[model samples]
Each structure stands twice: as structure tokens, then as C-alpha cells.
Target: MATKSDEDRASSYEPSSAGSDESHIPDVQNDCCNPLEETKYIVSESMLMELFNVCRRCQRLATPTVHQRVGTMVKIAAECEFCGFTWLWCSQPHVGSIPAGNIGLSASILFTGALPSKFLRVLRCIGVATLTQRTFSNHQASLLFPVVARVWDRQQRDYVTRAEDRGKPLVIGGDGRADSPGHCAKFGSYSTIDLEEGTVIDIQLVQVMISFQRTILCCTTMVL
Candidate 1:
């Protein structure tokens, strides 16, 4: 049912570096903050081994060994059997002990508002190995969440300062949504936005018990 153009477009969305040695094993250096360093590739293990078959230093036949494989990250070493030359390669750059690939994937899942379990399931179904849910949760809690909190705090402070400097009341709107329909809802989020600025100014999450009204009151109090 698909036309050639449709297939081409679909294939274009695939990772450009898939199964390619040049992109799979980058020369990861101290420059981990490079945006290009964050790009991830899905590589075929067999094809990658071919590049390691000959030592770069000696041009002799070499044996490739996988030193470690952590989810999408792999550490490989090649040793020349004839000339005794050796070198190492890594599938991704590192942030201290944590692989950049793992952090990048975790951050993407959270930033895109994707449900972690379902997103991870799709990745596994496609045979693209990735960090597990536990690791994702840990990354969110330890690394991503703190960064988000700090940035959000700074943004909110800036907004408040700007509003005070303008010497005019902010034109704002507020709305609340329940997690589930009707009285059975146990959780809800209420958000406020600056209508003039067209930006969300605050979001408050609350747990519902006796009534949704009570949760709305809590959200309002926190926002205030």
C-alpha cells in the first residue's frame, strides 16, 4: 500500500549512522558537551567487528574483544596478533561513569512526555537495546530532575521579576485536569499561564481525596 516515496521518507527517518563504523565509534574526548557527541547509532555487531579486524597502527590482522556492554554503550579493544599493537574504542562518550547515550535516552523520554514503560517496550521490540526502566528512573531522579528543577526555578524567578518591573497586573488564565474521569480521579494537575505572554507560568500537581474542589484549592494555594 506504500509508494516508493513513502518508503524513502520512512527510511530517511532512520538513524543515519546505523550499522556504520565511523559514527558508531566516535573519538570521544574530554569534549562531552558537544551536541554531535550526543547522537546515538544502532550498529550491527558483526559489521563493527570488521573494522577492528585490522589494527589501525600496524595494518595487521587483529582480534577484537568486547570489554563491556552497558545497554547501548559498548567498549571494544583491538589487539594486533602479529605486531602487538592495541587500541580501544567506545560506542559513546561518557559523563564520568555514566554513558552519555543512557543519559540522552532518559532525558529524551522525559522531555517528550512519553510513558517510560511503553516507550521502552517499543525500543526493545525494534531490537534496539537501551537502558532498563530502573536505570531510566534513577537517571530521572538523580540527574534530569535536578536540572529541570533548577532551570524552572530560575525561569519562574525571571518571570516574577519582569512582572514586578512592568508595574501592571499580569493577565493570566488557570485550568485543572483530572487524571481520570469523574469522581474516581485520584490525582490532578492545575496549570496557570500568562495570557499576554502566551507562556505557562506554573503547574501544580495535587492528590485528590474527598473532592476535586479541595485539590483545586491546594493547587491554587501552592501557585499563590
Candidate 2:
């Protein structure tokens, strides 16, 4: 026969939520929030470029073969020479996932007074709508955007080198603008350009909270 104490001990061992109240739980508010990522389908250009040409497991060459094409957009399939592991790859500025290169390109275009909608519109006109602009925009905001300054600097250096090779002095120009129609806007920008080449050499931004003079002093700050 069980004693009263035994019954109490058994009840204590059973599940109880903070004096039998679920509300006391921390970290988990309602256990009803949906996950932000549904399915991970993103692949970068560098990754794809390397994926098909090398065996991930055996470290051997994976001879790439063309599998499909939608006009210039291609899907390159490969099988490893040693392990026989197979995978698919795509070209630069991915039609499936937005490439890191495109992140910088899109940013440069925006810096040059072009709207992001123009990129989307061009993609649509080309019949390459496998990827959405929103997805690329999100990627630019999250991942590739942080390193775009380095990319821009590299681009400028390369362009300068090319101009030097041409043995001609660069005809440079500059401009600045508010992001919106009115002066009371959240953001503004300043840019220097290679007028002869029609390429932006460098750009900078100024937040509304900061003074315009300070914008000149610390104006190398860029945005995406």
C-alpha cells in the first residue's frame, strides 16, 4: 500500500510548469511564430564556379557538362572523376540565386542614379525571371552588402589602371543629390566620375541627421 507521502512524491516527479502555470515560461512566448527561412535555395557565383569543376568529397576534377539552357542562362551539370558525386551549377549573376557580383553591380547602378526597378524590369524583358528582385534585395541587405566598399575600391583601382594603360589623363566629374524629390529626405549622396569613360570612380553618402559640411569631411561613407 502506498503512503500519502509516496503519492505526493509521485505527483512531484510528474510534469509541472512553474506552479502549474505555463505563462511563467521565458524565451518561448507563444510557440507559434513561423520560421523566417522556408527553404534554403541560395548559391553564390564563386560557389557555383568552384562546385562543378571540383569534387567536393574526393578533391578531384568534376568534368562539367551542359545540361540545359534558357537562352544564355545555362545549367552546368558535373560528375566527379573519382567519387562520382554529381551536382548542378549556373553562370555568374545567377538566374536562380543572386550572385555577390550582382550585389555590387546593382549597388553601383543605384549609386549612378539608376533605380533598382530598372534591373528588375530589364530581367523581366530578357525573360529571365527565375529569381525575384525582392530576394536579391534581401541578400544585398543581409550578406553581400557589407563588403561592397572593398569591391568598389577594387573596381576603381582596376579602372584607374586601365586608364593609365591607355596613356591618357582621366576627365573626372562629380555630382550630389537628395534620394527623394524634396530636401527633407532620409539620405543623400555624392559621387566623383570618370566623365570620359562614363564610369563612376567613387561615391559617398550623407544622412539627414548629419550636417552637409561633415558630409564633405566624412563623405566617403557609402550605402547599398
The per-prediction tally of clashing pairs is 0, 0
**Residue-by-residue lDDT tens digits, candidate 1, 51-132:** 8999898788999989767767888999999989988887777554466777788888999999999999998998887778
Clashing pairs in 1: none
TM-score of every model?
0.72, 0.32
**CA lDDT, candidate 1, residue 172:** 71
How well does model 1 score by local distance difference test? Answer: 0.70
In order, what lDDT does every prediction score? 0.70, 0.52
**Candidate 1 lDDT score at position 78:** 90
Residue-by-residue lDDT tens digits, candidate 2, 1-224: 24557546543332222222111212211134322212224454456566568787787988877665432235678899888898865543331232323434445554676666776678567655233455445545544444454456567667757876878655666667766665667677766666778887666676644544565444232211
